[model samples]
Target: MIEVQGLTKQYRSVRAVDDLSFEVKPGKVTGFLGPNGAGKSTTMRMIVGLDEPTAGSALIHGTPYSKLKNPLRTIGCLLDAKAVHPNRSAAAHLKWMAQSNGIATSRVKEVLELVGLSDVAKKKAGGFSLGMGQRLGLASALLGDPEILILDEPVNGLDPEGIRWVRSLVRALAAEGRSVLISSHLLSEMALTADHLVVIGRGKLIADQPTYEFVKEHSASNVLVRTDFVPEFSQALENENVEFTSTHDEEGREQLLIRDQTTDYVGNLAYSVGVPLTELTLKRASLEDAFMDLTSDSVQYHAEALPGEDSDAS
Candidate 1:
């Protein structure tokens, strides 16, 4: 297990990570999330001893990372896939890491196979594509068969198949009672892969909870209905004190977005009001929705919306 308490990092006048406290527990995949410039990378660096924290501590199995006698056997990380030497072959890279960590040379081959890089073991890392480099980095992370894993954008530049493979691999490792912490911008895949989430914004802790609970609390599911009697239905909804908004599609047909009500309730109300419905479906909120809602203010970079487009549009 990895425990962080009151962790902080200050660069001159800016605080990169401020009193961040969270735990990566065994038998589960904990997703570390934050917007750009939110200090996620800084916090991870402090946790792994890459950077000195200004305050507090990050402990792996009750020991600080710098104090670990066999760091690789206890924790493995892939913070940067391109950190390896450009001239080294995949096999040579893993072999050296294994030697440094007192791991068997045979284990290097095992991890290379596990990450599907055995076929390219003899190839220079500099020649590998982005996806192949990511695979090689994963192979090094697994070289020691560590009990804890920290992966930053492990699936970055991977194809759909490689993404799925990584999802399965981390989940399987967690199921074996190892702790896994992954940080990525892929919200959809994180929703599928992570059992829990640690959300931070602007170097402050925002949320720590189960994946389902986090989504349920931060996002709202709404019922969308399209009807012939738009006027009547709108009036009925107002009379029933149902919160709703009206919007038009590209073809200019009106639709009602009813919040705080289920599809069944909306359908029954439409039926009672003699409204003929063309569509009634629940629009469930995804992890992307929740992330956007929760971290809107924490995002340091903002992209201008297109003309006629609003943040709340649809």
Candidate 2:
């Protein structure tokens, strides 16, 4: 497990990370989420000893990364996929990392194949596309066979196929009981990939919970109902004094947005009143929705909305 206690970082007057605390446990893929300049990179840097924390500490297992004799074996991180020498081949790059960590040179071939880069192992990293470079970086991280993996935007430049590949790889790693911490902006993929989430904003912990629980907590309980018998259905709802708002969908169908309501209740009500229904959909809150709602106040920066767009969305 990776443990952080009161992890804090300061740059003059700005507290990049402020008394942040969390745990990335083994046997699960945990997602790290935060907006730009929310101290995510700063915190990760602190964990890997690339940057000094103004206060508190981060532990890989029982020791700080700086104090570890074989740090690569304990934690594998891919903060930047293109941070390697541009002139080196994929195999040669992994070889150097393996040598530095005293790992077996033979493992380079194994990891290259693991990341599906064996066919292009001899290609110079400078010429490799972003997706290929990401694979090479992943190969280096896996070369050490570390117990913990921290990846930042592993799917940054990947196509649909590459995205799915990374998802499966991370899940496989977690299934083997490795602690995996991933950070990415792809909310839909994160929802599919991570077992849990660690969300932060403005250097403070906003939420830390299971994936489903976090989503369910902030999800809007809106039951959208559409029917050709709009007047009859609206009358039934009105007779029972059910709280709902009316709106038209993109297709010009009348839709009732009911809050604090369940599909069962709406369906049963319509059925009892003999109002035929065409569609009943319970719009569950997505990870993106929860992230935005929870971190609204903690956001340090804001984007101006286009004319006629909802300015209150952020």
Candidate 3:
């Protein structure tokens, strides 16, 4: 298990990580989530000893990262897939890492096969595609056959198949009683891969809970209603003090997105008020929608449309 207690990092006046505390239990995948500049990478760096924490501690199996005699055998990480030498072959790269960490050279081949890079084992790291590079990085992480794995953006450039592979691999690893802490912005994939989440914002802990629980707490499911007597239904909703937003469908039909009310309630209300209802549906909050809502204010970076992104009809 990985435990971070009051992990804090300060760089001059800016606090990169606040007094954050959370535990990644064994046999589960804990997703680390935050917006850009939210101090997620900084916290991960501190956890693995890449950066010094101003205060608090990070422990793996009750021991600090620096205190581990055989660090690789205890923890494996892929914080930066591109940190390897560009000139070296994938095999050569893993071989050197294994040598440095006292891992067997035979284990390097095993990991290469595990990550499906055995076919391109001889290719230079620089020539590999982003997906291939990510695979190679994963190979290095598994070199030690550690019980703990920490991966950041493991599927950054992966295809659909590769993403599925990674998801299955992580779940299988956790099933074997290993601890997995993954950090990624791919909410849909993260929702499928991780059993739990550790959400941070502005360097502070925002949420730490199970996947569905977090969504249930941070997002609400709404009811969508469509009616032909739009003004009549609108007046009825207003009379009943029901909150709803109006939008137009592709066919120019008016639609009402009703919040804090169930479809049955809205449908019955329309029926009682003689409002001809064309449709009524429930729209549950997805993991992506919940993530956007929870971290909306925590987002520090915003960008406008790029060149040619907005084309004028005129």
Candidate 4:
């Protein structure tokens, strides 16, 4: 398990990670989510002791990472896949790491096979592709068979098959009772892989909840209804305090947005009011939509219109 309590990191006058606190338990995959420049990398660095926290602490299995004996044996992390020496072969890289920490050379080959890099273990890492580099990094992290795994953008440049492989590997690690904390900007991918989510914005914690609970609370699952009786449907919806948005249909019918709670209620209301319903479709917000709505204001960059496309120029 990993626990971050009141963690804060400051570089000069700017705070990169505010007082953030959260826990990543074993047997589950927890996704760390945030927009760009939201202190995610800084926070991960602090957790692994690469960057010291200005205040508070991060603990792996109840012990501070800095205080751990043979820290890599307790908590394996892949903060940067490109941190390896380019000239060294993947096998040689792991060999040096194992020798430095007194781990057997046999473990190096074990992890290489585990990460599916056994075929090119002797190839120089500089010539490897991004996906191959990521696999090598993962193999190094698993070298010690640690209890916890922390990965930052592990699938950043991976192809579809490589992405699937990483996802399955992380899930399998958690299933074996190891703690896994993965940070990514892809909400849809997280929705498919993570059981819980920790969201941050501007270095502050925005949400820490189960994946299902977060979506259920923040995403609106509404149904769209279209009918010809505009006046009657509008009156009925208003009387029932149902929140809705209106648009005109091609046939001049009224289109109504009905919240989940009022889906059946509105259908009954339309029938009682003698209004014929032409269409009713349920629309549930996806993880991507929920993430956008939550972090819209926290986005660091906004796209502007092209030079010829102005509001008044058109």
**Model 1 per-residue lDDT at 187:** 99
Best by lDDT: 1
Model 4 clashing residue pairs (backbone): none
- Per-candidate local distance difference test: 0.93, 0.91, 0.90, 0.87
RMSD of 2: 1.5
TM-score-sorted candidate list, best first: 1, 2, 3, 4
How many clashes show up per model? 0, 0, 0, 0
How large is the C-alpha RMSD of every model relative to the true structure?
Answer: 1.4, 1.5, 3.5, 3.6
**Please, what are the lDDT tens digits per residue for candidate 3 over residues 1-314?**
99999999999999989999999999999999998989989988998999999999999999999999778898999999999899999999999888888888999889999999988888889998999989988887788999999999999989999999999999999999999999998999998999999999999999999999998889888898887788898888899888889987888877999887888899889889888777889998878878888887888875665785642211
Winner by TM-score: 1
Stretches of candidate 2 above 4 Å error?
Answer: 238-241
Identify the superior model by TM-score, candidate 2 or candidate 4. Answer: 2
Candidate 1, residues 1-314, lDDT tens digits: the string is: 99999999999999999999999999999999999999888888888999999999999999999999779999999999999899999999999999998998999889888999888999899999999999998988888899999999999999999999999999999999999999999999999999999999999999999999999999999999998888999999999999999998889988989997898899888889889899999999889999999999888888878787895522
lDDT of 4 by residue, 25-104 (tens): 99999999998899999999999888989998999888888898877688888999999899999999999988876678
The parts of candidate 4 lying over 4 Å away from their true place are 227-232, 247-254, 260-263, 274-278, 305-314
TM-score of each: 0.97, 0.96, 0.91, 0.88
Question: Candidate 1: misplaced stretches above 4 Å?
Answer: 311-314
Q: Residue 312 in candidate 2 has what lDDT? A: 72
